[model samples]
Target: MDRLEKMLVDIRAFVAEREWEPFHDPKNLAMAVASEAGELLSELRWVKGEDADAHCREPEARRRVADEVADVAITLLMLADRIELDLPAEVHRKLVKNREKYPVEEWRGR
Candidate 1:
């Protein structure tokens, strides 16, 4: 299976092992997503512009950013699974919608 699929399998097992699915209502999962995103922001809070890219190159900083980003993604994947949403298909739909919402001719050169 693909990496995402494998991760989902592992996540399901993790949650099941802890009997945490019952506690992961939509509201709590959304809150967890927001909290994890805030943590991602914190990793770059002090950096500015192109400098933030360099900051992320530091091993420890990179690890921190990766961990926080993973947390956000994990929570989102769980939310999608819990809600019976096809996350990849939904992402494709949004991409199509955005192609219209942000027509290329009008947004090309910045």
Candidate 2:
């Protein structure tokens, strides 16, 4: 399987190992995602551009970021799996929609 598939499989196994799947309902998972995202944003509370990049380069800070990112991904994937959603397909569909909304030729303000 590809990297993302492998990661998802591993995440599933990790959740199952902890017997956390039962608690991973859509609402809770979405809340967990938001919390993790908040944690990520916290790292940059007073930082800007180059400073934020430098903060990410530090080992401990990088680990914290990775942990938060993993938490968000785990919650998101669990929610998607619970709803029988095809993540890759949904991602493609969303990208297509976004492309229509903000075409390259008309895109501005990164």
Task: Residues 32-96, candidate 1: write the lDDT tens digits.
Answer: 99999999999999798779988999999999999999999999999998898988899999999
Worst 10 residues of 1 by lDDT: 46-55
lDDT tens per residue, model 2, 14-65: 8889998789888888888898889888877888786888899899999988
Q: Candidate 2 regions off by >4 Å?
A: none
On the 0 to 100 scale, the lDDT of residue 42 in model 2 is 86
| Candidate 2 positional error at 20, Å | 2.1
Candidate 2, backbone clash total: 0
Let me know the TM-score candidate 2 reaches against the reference structure. Answer: 0.86
Superposition error at 37 for model 1 (Å): 0.2
